[model samples]
Target chain A: DARVTQTPRHKVTEMGQEVTMRCQPILGHNTVFWYRQTMMQGLELLAYFRNRAPLDDSGMPKDRFSAEMPDATLATLKIQPSEPRDSAVYFCASGPGALDNQPQHFGDGTRLSIL
Target chain B: DQQVKQNSPSLSVQEGRISILNCDYTNSMFDYFLWYKKYPAEGPTFLISISSIKDKNEDGRFTVFLNKSAKHLSLHIVPSQPGDSAVYFCAAIPGTASKLTFGTGTRLQVTL
Candidate 1:
């Protein structure tokens, strides 16, 4: 089955270090989304892209968080000078079209730990 | 404010019994709703979805019912099995393929 794939399933870093996560969405899917999951906050949409164009990133903290889809096969979410509060599982999801009702397929996710 | 809410933290049901999970949404603009199941260390998998235009959608053992007036939805699983145990999430999409706002998950435990 075609599934979204994410790199570095697990990562541990210092509080001020940089953390980068990568994802490959399912082929032929047009919409890509980045989300964070923590025990307290269920799931927050950090950013979303359509046809490699970023649609909305208001959910992301402008200073430390950045998301990009350099190409259709790859999407990256990077956090610089990460804080302990940044520890969470980051997920990448993709959908078939620009329709709200289309079901999204998600990646296993990258679990990040900032100490 | 939480747009989607799954108030129950967990639910326990006996095996072979029917399990009904509920979800409520505050956003009237949300036109699409979906239910997802997630295992530990795994991504949330699509279970079922119902559009605003339809009141209900079903696939095999899983059925999702949507009530537009109340902005509520429920997932019904018949003959629940141990394998069905997992965390379930309710998500709402406000616009066409827009960002999904998810609710805190509800863990379903199917005891044998």
Candidate 2:
């Protein structure tokens, strides 16, 4: 019964709008990851956090995209002035830290559409 | 460059048969490989995994085989069922970052 949960299962917005997605990872899990999925690029990692602290955001566009884990149970991915290229399914996953080989558990993703 | 590749975009198999899905990688540093199964409108689910140290790993009906020399690995599902119809993705990690580099997934259709 334990699983990651995400909000706003689908979203549609005009270009240059702000979009925010939220995730509630499985209880007691310390690692969370954000990924973007597109037709051309397949799946790409955007960011990851360990123990509610950002570990890697190398795949994210710093100018407009930011990810944060304000608390242990909640994580968020926000995009400001979103562009058409940003239209894709965004997924959030969580797992125990590396001490366990941490197989990520994913939530049903949020599908974003930019007009 | 695509570090991992699943050249076959899709595969079709009949029920009660074995389905083989292949994946190739270019990075030799990748020491761990995993397979995930995803249904439409759902996120990918962990299926099985094998570390470079071992050539094969199995759990129930799923098995993963790794070939270090070729930088290749495969997932075999025995007695494929219609419920097994889903996209399968192969992933690898270069180091211990917990970050996974994934390949374009292969869609499998198990028909009766």
* Worst ten in a row by lDDT for model 2 chain B: B93-102
Candidate 2 root-mean-square deviation in Å: 1.0
Instruction: Kindly report which residue stretches of model 1 are placed more than 4 angstroms away from their true locations once superposed.
Output: none
Residues A1-115, model 1: lDDT tens digits: 9999999899999999999999999999999999999877799999999999999999999999999999999999999989999999999999987675689999999999999
Worst 10 residues of 1 chain B by lDDT: B92-101
User: Tens digits of per-residue lDDT for model 2 on B6-109?
Assistant: 99999999999999999999988899898999999999999999989999999998999999999999999998999999999999986655679888899999
The model with the greatest DockQ is 1
Docking quality tier of candidate 1? medium
Q: Rate the local accuracy (lDDT) of all candidates.
A: 0.93, 0.93
Clashes of each: 2, 0
